[model samples]
Every structure is written in structure tokens, then in C-alpha cells.
Target chain A: MTDTQNSRDAVVIERTFDAPVVLIWRMWTEPEFLKEWYGPDGASIPIANMDVRVGGIRRVCMEMPSPNGPMQMWFTGEYREVVEHQRLVYTESVSAESGPVLSPTSPGTAGGHPMMTEVRVELEAVGNRTKMVMTHAGVPSDSPGAAGWAMALDKLAANIATNRGR
Target chain B: MTTAIDEDRLTETFAALANSTRRAILARLAEGGATVNELAEPFTLTLPAISKHIKVLERAGLVVRGQRAQYRPCVLDATPLEAVSTWADRYRPVWEARFDRMDDYLRQLRRQEGASEADD
Candidate 1:
């Protein structure tokens, strides 16, 4: 689907920071700085390996507390494009510690993999401040993968409505 | 940790949701529980086909079929869908925190730069 159509599925976040583009870029590309703020609340990043060149590999691990105790989620990706202080594009996938885990049905492919997505980050310098627009694509929208979810949610609303006698 | 198992279930849930007809059946169930015949009313598919769709939803833990007398009503179980929604939203807070930290780090760096410039 086109980006416009896929917008419904994608998560687009735009923020302006009172920092130069160079500094903002470092926060994203430098592992030490990235680890400080790259995870959800209550999660920590113990390992972040980032190779800022094109075709370089990036591996990050985010550990969070689960009901069963601590759990680590590994994400591995490759840098498809890296423009200094301006833009970065990567294809990321959830994986095990060893490496990318092949799906049982598709031995060599990660397509249709729910945990896989493409991230595009664009940084623009506005005077000394920086404006960043991050688009997380590959979130299945009305496609077969997510078609049921949209409809199921609608049905759920309907069920709730009927039960409330409204 | 059962993380692998949870991931597998998430995959199954996505796969089960990948069909329009199955989604329609689920929408029907959301109105209330219904037998195979009642669920299949909106679709042109056969009873067996509807049953098959219900089975997929059941396997994904999105639906539960009640065993009542002659009517086996399929009820919508939104727990799994809620999980899916939560997963989708997992990154928002992550990036927000990262940006906040970046702001602090940048302010510190600028202050150091100013101090060194004055010393020079």
C-alpha cells in the first residue's frame, strides 16, 4: 500500500527538540546515548550495537519486567540508508539472542512476520533546533494480517453497545 | 520465560485476523453469541465454512464457543485483541523517553561547549 494508505497502520511521531541536528543525530546513532532513552518506561537497554554505515547491522536488546520475571526482547536490523545528521532508514526484526529466527512456515523469509517493520527517521535543522519525523512502517493495515483485527474491534463495539441496552 | 510462546501466539492471532470473512463472523459474534447458522447469515458461505472461520478465531483466543444445549454460541473474547493493541502502542512511550533524555544530554553538552569557548 502507498504511504498515505498505510498511514492508518503506521505510527508517525514528529517532535521538535531544542538541540542541533548533529546532537540529535548522535543520540540516535551512538549506543551509549541511545541506551539512555531507547526503551519504554520500566525497561532498560543492556546491549545496543549500532553500525552507522549503510548495510551495517544494528542489534539492540530491551529488557522489561514481566509477570514471570524479567524478559529481554532482541531486535536486529540493517541500515539501508544513512545520511549524516539528516535521515536514517532501517529494516528491523525481532529475533532471538543467537540471530534472526526463521518462521516455521517460511524458512528463509521474514515477510508476514508480525514483529518486523521498517523505520524511517528524518531530521531537519530549524535554526539551532531540530525537527524529527519518525515513521514506523510495515504495520499491516487493512491487509489480511490486520483485516480481522479492525473488524473484530468493530464487532466488539457492537457487542458492547447491545449489552448496554443502548 | 515463555517469550517465544507468547510471540507464537501473537503470530497466530495476527494470522487469524488476516481474513475478511472471518472478521465479519467475529463482528456478528460481537453482537452476542450465535450458532454457526446465525453467524453465517450475513455471508454467502456455507455452515461448514463459517465453522472453520470460528475455529480459527477460537484458536487465536479471540472467540469462545459456548456449549449450551443445541445452540453453540460463539462469544467474542477481546483479551487477545487487547494484547495486540498494546503491542502496537508499545513504542510511543519508548521514543518519548528517549527524546526527553536527548534534550537533557544536549543541554549539558551545550553548556560545556559555552564554558570551553569562554576559557579559550
Candidate 2:
């Protein structure tokens, strides 16, 4: 059931790098390389423990500045499949520093469990370059989960009747 | 970056929006401010139950009740909705930046390789 939900709410991103497939794969699998560019600008990965093999666990912490203070978010995932430079798949869960997964009720808050999602990275060699297609599956857009709020809001936006009652 | 207060509000807003009856009431109110009875007309729920839903929406800042009139019609306030949309879109720029950084790193790697080959 969750698998179907994830496929339905997946968000995909594709990028082509002017580098070989081997180098691109390293950027994803190696903690040293991943820490350099895993998150957005101004966000730092303070802790990155990546065991790239299948069934290995990958734990990372992304810290960024917030209005209140410095905010840290922990993500833990297990690699479901690893196909060298060709493909990689994993399941991700957002958790707290102590390691228990958070709930989705309080998004962006410390210790709030955002929905778990699967990520698939497919790398194809294109001459000297590499084409990477990243599919973040099961984003919970409308499932009985965190994304349900966003979906309901969308429905409300669409169903709003502009006709004012006099 | 999102603050804890903002996150709390978002959570409240989502919780308020989770119910189908409340969503229907909000849709009705979006058309125009309606009294509790008017909002309850479409659903099989009792007037008090609809009022309870309105209270939740009001707490979440999604709905506002007029004070000047006796009926106090519930009005839809879309400010929280806008916040929800912004939160949803927050990940896009992050991923874009990550990709751009990766591109830059790849260029640097190629440069080093080219320099090393020339030295050899």
C-alpha cells in the first residue's frame, strides 16, 4: 500500500553532468564527496556516515540557520540496491539526533517525523558526461500522511467559488 | 529557513484541514462569508458540529468570524494556505543548488585531471 502511495506522489529531478559516470557515482556514494554538495547553499552536513553497499545504513545531518537559531535535521536511510555506477536505491526517514524517527505533525520542527520516501538515482554514461535521473518516490502528496495537508489545500484552492453571496 | 513557530502554525493548519467536513465548510466559506447554519446546510452534520469545525479553522488562522454582526459569518482567510504552498516549494531551490554545486565540482575535477596529465 505504501509502495503504491509513494509511486503516485514521487517527485523527479534530472540533471546531466559534464563528468564521467564513475565520478558522478562517487559524489553520491562517498561521504566526503557527498558532504560537499549534498544540500543547498548555506546548508552544511555536519555528520555523514554512508555505507554504500546494499542493506547498509546511511545517516546524515543537515544543519542550517533559522530565525530562532541554528537548526539541525537528521536523515537515516538504508540502501535497498546499489548497482555500481548505473543505479542506486534507498529508503529515507527523517529523525532526531538521538535516532528515533519524528512524526509529520510538526514539519521543519526538531524531532518531527517527516514522511519516509524512497530515492532512486540512475546514472547513464553519455559520451564523457553522465546523465543522472533522480526519482524521489512516495513523497506523500495526498497519502494519509504529511502531504495530505498540501493536497487538501490544493483542493480548497481549486474549489473556491469566486461568486460572492450578496 | 522556517522557524519553529511557523512550523507549529503549519502543523495546526494541516490538522485543521485534515477533515473532509471542515474542507467542505472552508470551500463554502471561500465563496462568501456564511453563518454557521448556512455552512451546515450542505452537510448532514449538526449546526454545533459545524461550529466546532469553524472554531478549528479559526484557530488555524484559515477562517475569521466577523464580530460586528450577530451571526458572525465565517470568512475564509487564505494567508495560511499561502504559507503551506511556500513550505511545499521549499525543497525545489535546495535541490537546484545541490545540482549546480555538483556541476561546479565536476568542472574542478576535470581541471585537476587535465593539469596532472600535462605534468606527466
Candidate 3:
């Protein structure tokens, strides 16, 4: 009954790109191609060094121009699965720019623990187009800081149901 | 757009809600306001221990206690729960923007490929 409620904890997006599956796969895996459109419309990803192999390092630094100043973020993850144009899974940590993963007790982190999210992309060829289903959700069970995520994701729906029932 | 303070509060709120006992207390309070002893009836915790949990919920802004010491009823505050729900939506916009850029880049790559083929 809380299927919809559970879905609220994650971001699931499906989009069809105007290209074949191969191209779509490249756009996600390759560094140059990923940097071309990895952040906001105007934001530039200064560095996107990706090794598209299982267990390979995926380090990317996104620099965005904000009114306050230039904001920079470094995301470090490892390629969990590399299925070559079919499915790709990776771990993404929204950490400080080129620093340690902010701790759960770190102030202002809000959600406690660094935001360790998993990104899974599935691609299917549909003629000249490619259908992509991307899921950005909590960290894997084995990942560090994931214990906190388990709490954040698990009780949310029940919490909401309890509160909303009143 | 969640600011620094909101994020701080969310962290606090989540930390408070992380405990099973704390969550149960919140659920119990949702039914109606109750004194510390009344709230502790369903649980196997002591009065001071239950009061400690109530203190956490109060700090998280999830509960408020009455002023009268004789009977300060602990009431559930739905405000922080609202924050949790809203925070769930924080990722969609960022991803949408990134996907928009991905779409544009794909189109541009196609055009570049066509241009190179024309050169051949």
C-alpha cells in the first residue's frame, strides 16, 4: 500500500533520447561526453575522469557559477557494474570538493552522513531512439555511511503514514 | 531550496527519528497528547528514559510540551515530518536539469557526427 509512499524516497526518471543505445551509453560512460551535459544547463564540469570498467574509479568535479560565487562539488564513486550499453550501476558520493566524505555528524549536512546515492542506468534500443531508465536512490547496503541511509529510507514512509493518519 | 539552517534542522530531525523507540513515541503521540508517564505505558522504558526521548523529539521540533509542570502533555508536531517529505523531492530538479543537458549534448553529438560524415 505504501508503494507510492516508498517511491518518494528515491528519484526515478525515464527518458528517451534521440539517439541509439550505443550513443546513449557513451554519453554516460565517457568522460568528455559526460562532461558535455552533466550538471545544470550553464554549469561546467571541469573534470570528468571516468574508467568505464567494473570497480574502476569515477571521479567528477562539477563547477557551477552561482550568484554567491563559484560552487564546486567533487563526486567520487566506483563503477559497480558495466554491462556495455545495457546496464550500468555506480556509487556516487556528494562530498566536498576533493575532500573526505563529510561525516554523518558533520554540521549542516542535513540528512546526516554524506549523501551516498546509487545511480543505475538501463538502456534499451528502440529503433533510432534509446529508452533510458535512471534510478538515483540510497547507497548500497555494503557501502560506507549506508547505515544512516537505511534509516533515512526505511522509516520515512511509515513515519509519513503515521503522521498523516492523524 | 533548502538553506543551511533548514538542512541543519533536517539533520537534527532525522537523527531524532532514527531511533525505533523515538519513532514509536512519535506514533503514539500522533494518537493524542499524553503525559510522560502515559506515553511510557506502552513501552518498556522508565519515566526518565521516556522523558529523554521526549526531549529529543522536542529538540527536533517534532513535539511540543505544555508549560504547566503538573501536567505538561506532549503533543506531536507534524512540522518536521513535512520537512522530511519535502526533502524527498530535493533530487528531482537537479536530475531534471542534468538530464536536460544530457539531451542537448546528445543532439549536439549527433550533429557533429553528421558534419564529420559530410566531410567524408
| Candidate structures ordered by lDDT, highest first | 3, 2, 1
Q: Model 2, residue A112: what's the lDDT?
A: 44
* Best-performing candidate as measured by TM-score: 3
- Put down candidate 3 lDDT per residue, B22-117, tens digits, no spaces: 878877777778888899999888889999999989998999999987889998887877766666588788788888988887778779899999
DockQ of each: 0.37, 0.32, 0.38
Q: Which stretches of candidate 2 lie over 4 Å from their true place?
A: A1-13, A39-43, A50-58, A63-128, A133-152, A158-166, B68-70, B116-120
Report the lDDT tens digits of candidate 1 across residue range A1-166.
2342233235577889888888788888998888766776788899898988888878789888879787787777778799999999876667544445544333215543435556888999999999998876543322525433444554555565576584
Fnat of candidates, each listed: 0.30, 0.33, 0.36
lDDT of 2 by residue, B1-120 (tens): 344455556657666777778888888877878888889898898888888889999998999989967798788998887776565356556667788999888788889999999999
Candidate 2: CAPRI quality band = acceptable
Q: Per-residue lDDT for A41-141 in model 3, tens only?
A: 66788888888888787888888788978877777777889999999998776654434444322212323344455788889999999999888764332
TM-score of chain B of 3: 0.92
Q: Over 4 Å off in model 1, which ranges?
A: A1-12, A39-46, A51-56, A62-72, A78-86, A91-114, A135-165, B1-9, B88-90
Give the C-alpha miss distance for residue A48 in model 3, angstroms.
2.5
Worst 10 residues of 3 chain B by lDDT: B1-10
Q: Report RMSD (Å) for each prediction in the order shown.
A: 5.2, 5.8, 4.8
Q: After superposition, how far is residue A72 of candidate 1 from its true place, in Å?
A: 4.2
- For each candidate, what is the lDDT? 0.70, 0.72, 0.72
Question: Which candidate model has the greater DockQ, 1 or 3?
Answer: 3
Clashing pairs in 3: A104-A113
